[model samples]
Target: MRIFPARLPDCLILQPQRYQDNRGFFQETFRAADYAKAGISEPLVQDNWSRSVKGVLRGMHFQRLAPQGKMVSVLRGEIYDVAVDIRPGSASFGQWQGLVLSEHNGHQLWLPPGFAHGFLVLSDVADVIYKTSAYYQADDEGSFCCFSAALNIDWPVTDVIRSAKDAGAPDFSTVFP
Candidate 1:
């Protein structure tokens, strides 16, 4: 497995080595020892999975009081995934990194705590799975609009589908004081 840092150095793009044969393929998606080497000492306590159709956009979301670092991967389709730095006082604060993740690429994105995560489904349907360092706490939820003017993210999609919560997220400030 190899790891490359994204534009935001704290975030990483992980390439897991896949050994393929006539029968199928094998690879280690996550190994505590290997992850520890990458400075991810937190124990991933929850694994969440979601499926969305094309044009669906979710997030720019995070947990404020109990921030959760995430390792995101796509299992069945493709998505334009993004991570934004919202950490106070950090050099890269307000910066973001976006990339395509799909089953074909066999890539995983790692977003450390203090970053907001979002993705737009590019395929007919997408199945995404992520492991979080901390269990989810509804009361701690935080969200920023994927299209917030302050961030001015250049989202590749035009016809977008978002929940009311995500639509209202634009009213929230991306910059933490």
Candidate 2:
């Protein structure tokens, strides 16, 4: 596995080495030791998956009480994955980073705790899967508007499919400090 560092500390883009033959291809998606070696100390506890069509946008979401650290990857098709550093006292606070993740790329993005995560579908249909270090809590849930000017995330698609809850999510200025 090749672990590439992202702009934010503790965040990484991990690419697995694939071995292909006439039959097909083989790759190990995750290995505890390899993650440990990469300095990812968080122990993943829950796994989640979502399917989205082209132009669908899912987040800019996080939890205040139990902010989940996620390892996200595309299972089918592709997406523009994004993470915003929201740690109140961190140097990268309010800063964001993005990457294009596709099934062909075999890459995963690790978003440590204290960050907000979201993604936009870049293909006809995309299946996104991820592991989280924390279980979800409704009361802890919060989100910033996907296109909030304060963060200025450049969502690739102009027309984004969003849930009413997400569409009504508070802007960062109102919720985040």
Candidate 3:
């Protein structure tokens, strides 16, 4: 596997080496020692999967009490994935990065704790799977409007579908749906 440093120095974009024959291909998505060598020390403890259709957007979310370090990749279809550095005292605070992750690309993104994670489905349907360093705590989760001007993300699509909670968030409720 090869790891590429992203615009946000703390984040990483990984390309897993694939070996192929006539039948199919094989790749190792995670290897602890390799990651540890790359400066990722968190031990992943949970895995989550989400499937969404095109035009669906989910999150700009993070957990205040238990911020998670996540390794995200797509299992099927495609998506525009984003990670925003929200750590108040960090050099990259308020900065964001976006990447196109598709099954064909076979790439993965790593966002350490203190970053808000979000994605927009770009295929008919997309299956996103991620491993996190910390367990989820619903009561500790915090979210910002995906289209908040404070962040002003250049999402590829305009007509999007959002969950009520996201749509009702401070800046999104009255504007930019």
Instruction: Please report the candidate that would top TM-score against the real structure.
Output: 2
TM-score computed on alpha carbons, candidate 1? 0.94
lDDT of 3 by residue, 1-177 (tens): 788999986899988888889998888877888888888899999999999999999997888878999999998999999999887688888788999998989999999999989999999999999999999999998888888887789999979999998787665323212
Worst 10 residues of 2 by lDDT: 168-177
What TM-score would each prediction reach against the true structure?
Answer: 0.94, 0.97, 0.94
**Residue pairs that clash (backbone atoms under 3 angstroms), model 2:** none
Worst 10 residues of 1 by lDDT: 168-177
**Which candidate leads in lDDT?**
2
lDDT of 1 by residue, 1-177 (tens): 788878996888888999999998888888888888877777899999999999999998999889999999999899999999988888988888899999888899989888999999999999999999999999999887788767788889968999998888853363353
lDDT of 2 by residue, 1-177 (tens): 898999888799999889999998998987989988988899999989899999899988998988999999888999999999889889888889989999999899999999999899999999999999999898999898988888888777869899998899888878875
Candidate 1, clashing residue pairs?
Answer: none
In candidate 2, residue 96 scores what lDDT?
A: 91
Backbone clashes in each candidate structure, one number apiece? 0, 0, 0
Candidate 2 clash figure, as a count: 0
